[model samples]
Target: MVSPFEAGMFSGPWRSLLSLREDVHVEETAEGDLVLHGRWGDVLLRQPDPVVRGVLNRMSLGPISLSNAVSGHGGGAHGAAAVLRVLDRIEPLVVRTVGRSDGRLLVSVAPIAPAARLRPEPLPADRPIRLSRFAMVRTDGSGYILESPLSLHRATLHHPGAVRMIGMLARATTTAEALGDPPDDRLLVDALVLLTAAGLVVRGEHAAAPAEKATFAEDTDPALAAWSPLDLMFHTRSTLGRHDHDFGATYPLGTGRSPEPVVRPAADGPVIALDRPAWEEILGVDPPLSVAVEGRRTARRYTGEPVSLRELGELLYRTARVRSLVLRQDGEEPSASSRPYPSGGSSYELEIYMTTTGGRDLPGGVYHYDPLGHRLEVVSTDPAIVAELLENARTAADASGTAAVLLTMTARFRRVSWKYRGPAYALMLKNLGALTQTLYLVATAMGLSASPLGAGDVDTSARALGVDWRVESSLGELLIGRPGTSSGDTGRLPVNDAAWAERAAAYLGVKRGG
Candidate 1:
């Protein structure tokens, strides 16, 4: 697992160099404990001696051969073995490197998962292999990085030659085939071992030495068949138990202060004041939770009646108005706010944009909802663009004509992005669902026809809302109108009958209790 770049010429074999990540540093505590802190997290050794500290200090400076770093420098085999155990404990903070025979570092692999044990193994010399469909190589601040949601570790490509080395992996090419003119360049072979160990490369069939022989280009896999590439990527990156990126209020990109304001300021325009509904009155008049939950449905057809301004006011007041703004960043907590719907870390980053189309009391235009003040700020009054915004929502909901009132939900990206790294966009989607459900239950109780939309065009809505797409973009949409004449409700039941339960249990190959 530990091979140091031997201090020699390019004629020698390639080796794995081990060291603590450059970002890692050592801090000796007052209680004589040693703290090894890095970008991943901090680990503490109860107490350590001078030699261990010396090796750690040397590791901070540059990559060293684990063997040479321990046994070669004053410390004997026993001391080196002791240090190796220490590295194993803090393995997440360590980076494994492989240098070409020229003594130039080509690629470095770092553990991303908590239980990751990165050790490169030789590829099957006979078979062809390719990069996993999920694996991606993007230009990072440090040249290029190859990472996959499936990978337990992330690999950074250091040399330009290494980048070219991976290009050979795009298609299923073998080791002997990849060997270039001099037949001495082991860069491709060595990198494949590390990348394969990281689960970024896959071959046609299974092998015993590797943990996973990613079945590449196989027939449709039932487990992964339904997922699109983008959908799968988003699913993994947005939640924990997968890849490692800085997450949760770390404020990785900031200047000490909270990057976003406690409340999003209203766009510049004349504010159209709306009547704020009293919470006590809403509580008394609204239907019980059981009734609203059971009654909620996607009502797409809207009666051809002008949606009253009062209806819009009541809906927004109950669903999304800012109840309070809590400034906790002064004490090092993230600044948060209160709304009817819940958000991760209380980051209410989603904004509501109401499209005024086929309305009675309100003019036809797109307006931004100012939740803090319970007012609507006109964003675009143009008739054509307003119609386009409404049309898009109608299409997304698959409704006829125009929606009585179309609610477009846009997320102030930085508001959540500032507090979260890997899970920011995923949090935005979760917040969208929370608000959508709130609207559904409230709309059901109030007797308004509501249909929650699954999609919205970011650029189209951004232009209509007069906001920068990068700053704030649409995440969800909903259509509301007067209840249309009902022929029949969609087939549904509040409780499953005995027969249905038995059938479901049979299909799942489980015995039913009753």
Candidate 2:
């Protein structure tokens, strides 16, 4: 049922009716009469009674109708007079229909009083007012818009005086006397009242009180702290379907060229062909999935022993090898390749690059893992750059040892952006997690040491790799080598549990062990 005026009117003296004896009840008779049974006695309004009919009809139409009926003689002069008298008696009562019973509408009547209107108080000449810290304001061609990040509230001020006043208030707190004189001052006071009611402004003294800053960190995932806003926005708008334009409208598969370099063997340059080892033989001696899972631990301290090139090749093939490529028909989607780890929209945007320091067969240089060719393409030969990369990997893993190999993960953003929107970057990160987990499990299965780093310096990696940061940039790092064999003692390696706990506590502002 629709409410007459959006809100119910308050009842005053009629509130006493609700406190009547518990046994008191109102029932309608088949003869069209209202019977009120109370502790004192029973009161009945007879059927066809003009006063009662008129009152009920006017009440059904709402208070506004009742007022109109009282002023007009449409209900007949005598009937109107009766309605007015009945209304006077129920002036302290709020009458409304609760529902319908059998064939008649049920009525609810209670006592209430009108609510008081808010009155604006004169602004103090001494105290200054400023916008709340939680409020954000911007100007458009049409007007000045005000919004509060703390709340989903927005206000637009189009009046020049209001805009000027808000601009003044935004810079710093100012009293009404300092805002200007006469009309401007009046407008400022009125605007202040409106803004105050909207929770956009606070008194300068109150705003100065120390309070925890309103932050999006409370709502955002901690793992996403490293994500840039531009990247996030691009990912969100491209994958989340929030943009106005149609997304995924066209098949994005073959739209853009692959960013991977074509590996044409150089005359003298090193291009190591990754041996395609038989997996059946490897699995015969490999531990069970359950055993592998249980044994998978992030190894921080590695033995100084160098990892064999065959082991590195096997690891890359098992975890990241492109199993098959599917090409689409004309007017259909383009082409996509499948890998062991699942990817967002089958857009395997993750690319692997490795820096080998003390590998048995691989030289100390930076190389890209060619998943399609099952080979490694040497990208950099500078010893200093390789040293820097190794140092970063060690720092990330928090281990002291000659890192046999370091894997740097980068993303080809357009691969996912072509078909997805805002959630593209997030999906890429998810793919990274899946790939990392796969690496951990496979490393365990192979009896190799592997440690996934929580973060890496993107700019430094980009510079060392000589790759355009926009096209591709490092997203994660992983260190791999032979596990240390020193009496099961991990030496000075960073403990993720403790570090993570400390960071978490700091973010939440909670004292540890408290």
Which candidate number has the best lDDT? Answer: 1
* Candidate 1: tens digits of C-alpha lDDT, residues 369-488: 898899888877799997787777778888865558888898888887775788888888889999999998787677666887777888888777778988888898888876565545
List residue ranges in candidate 1 displaced over 4 A.
1-12, 23-57, 74-91, 180-184, 206-221, 253-260, 266-268, 278-285, 325-337, 486-494, 497-514
Error of 2 at 475 (Å): 0.8
Error of 2 at 99 (Å): 45
On TM-score, the candidate that comes out on top is 1
> What overall lDDT goes with each candidate model?
0.73, 0.59
Which 10 residues in a row give candidate 1 its minimum summed lDDT?
505-514
Model 2 local distance difference test score: 0.59
TM-score: model 1 vs. ground truth:
0.81
Query: In every candidate, how many clashes are there?
Result: 1, 20
